[model samples]
Target: MRQNLNYSYPQIFWVEGRPNLGTSCPSAPPIAPFPPPVPDRRRKPKNHTERRSVGLLVTSLLILLALTGVGLSMFRIFHLEKELAELRESASTERIPPALEKLIGQKEQSMKKEARKAAHLTGNPSQRDLPLEWEPTSGHAFTSGIQYCDHGLVINETGFYFVYSNVLFRGSVCSNQVLTHVVYKKNPTLPGSHVLMEDKGINYCMSQKTWARKSYLGALFKLRKMDSLHVNVSKIALVNFEESKTFFGLFKL
Candidate 1:
């Protein structure tokens, strides 16, 4: 026998002898619709404006820290400068000692006196007297610290002086006798001329004919203002009148 079957309903399957419903291998079971997807509850995505605002806040904080550091450095520098200026001002106010100031003034006065007094006088050959007086040469006399008057040098300041003189004596014949040289000073306090230095030369020449001799006298003496000095020799005619050969000079020491 032949039979027509319909499969419109798949839940039921007909076997060779009986119709089966809910068979394990005849058809698949119905599938329930998928449940809605669960929402992500732990984290939320940030918007563009929120991200920009957070970055701006961080940038502002960093700028504020940098400016504070700069201000602190500048304040330290200014304080140090103020301290340095105060130190300088204090140093400027320090005082010098009175004794030192007086000493300095005295030294200045001494130097001024030294600058004002010096004299050098040369000799003239044509003069009289065995212990002859000397006149300053016409064009060769030097008077800076003192004055020259009539064959004498006058002091202008009271101080120690280095007095010096050079005399050249020559003759056609040698006497080899005693040659006397004297430097004398005349002052208001003394009655007559006082000798400051004296020298006597004996046997100074080895030759009997065409003999020549030279004498030099120099010494330090305390002289007063208004004192006058002169150079005197044993023989006037024997002395060389050459300005370079004979000279008398004194300087304040």
Candidate 2:
């Protein structure tokens, strides 16, 4: 059975002004905050006169350096020139003097005289200052040591010489060898340079036959001219104008 409703229900009306508490619409998107403003930087002020003055100062420094280098170079050049001039002057003043030249000449003469005397002592005593007769001035018997036989006086030392009594042979033949000697002659006006020997006669050989006979064999050397005489050596015969021979010998006084 339907019983009449006696209880009263609470009424809910939909109003536009207020929303329901349980249900909610999407919240409006949160707004982004504005960015902070950047501050302007301050620049230093320029001075035109100061920039020009600094440029001038740097240029002046460079110019001063160049000038200093040039001054040093000039000083060095002047110094070198002065030194060269002094050297030239010194050389001119130190040249040999005339009086000194005379003294040198005298000394040279003295040396020559001594040398001639020495040459006389060695052997090949020149006949110019020697006696013709055999006198034992050299303390050695001329005949005892005489190894060569010749036609003329063989000067061995200044005062001593060998004079052969007779000539055996004065001719030349073919020889594979030869001997040489220096003959000294007086260089008149030149002190101590006097001497002469067979060497002075070498160019006189007209033919090979003459050379073998006239060639200055070792034994034929004058005592004083022995120094000038070279021994029997190889190739001497080659230069020799003489024809080839097996053996050759020279005898002296």
Candidate 3:
């Protein structure tokens, strides 16, 4: 007898007297590889905005600090300027006391009066009279209370006057002789000149070559207005013209 086989259905086979089934089926479609993870675009925008806000905050803080510093400096400058202006205003409005002003005026007047009553004169090298003519030292000679005329100092005020004179005598040969210096005063009431003070130097230097002597006279006397005062030396030729060596002066007490 011939055997029949079927291909469209499952086939069964017997082994050791047990049945086993075999089946043929199409494979499932190949599974696609998992797709790459996508980035979270919303989260990225939020993070960027946060960073920008932080930057802006920092910039604002820095700007505020700068502006504060500038404002403080300007305030300090303005304060200093205001203080300076106040000081200037106070100085401009300040005034000296009246008592101080009066004292200053009195002092000035006293100084002027003192200046007017003093005189200093130097010897004249060309004088030939008994009463020596003196040349008043320009810077050192000043007389407001008296007039200097010819060889005489004419007093214009009456007071106790302190008179002084110095005569320096120098020669190639020492004279052991006496050297005399005198201060004399004359007035309308007196017929002639009266000696106020006299100085005599006897044997002032030893007899030798290049000898020098100085005669000085100083005294205080009551003087009348219009009194004329003069200086005299024993030998006019021996009198030194140097201001320091020979001088005459007077002051009122």
User: Which RMSD does model 3 reach against the true structure?
Assistant: 12.1
What's the lDDT for all of these models?
Answer: 0.81, 0.40, 0.81
Per-residue CA lDDT of model 1 for 94-190, tens digit only, reads: 6446897799999989887777688777776677754445555466776776888767888878889999998888888877578888889999877
Error of 3 at 31 (Å): 94
Model 1 clash count equals: 2
Deviating ranges (above 4 Å) for candidate 1: 1-113, 129-140
RMSD of each predicted structure? 11.7, 16.3, 12.1
Q: Least accurate stretch of 10 residues (summed lDDT) in model 2? A: 161-170
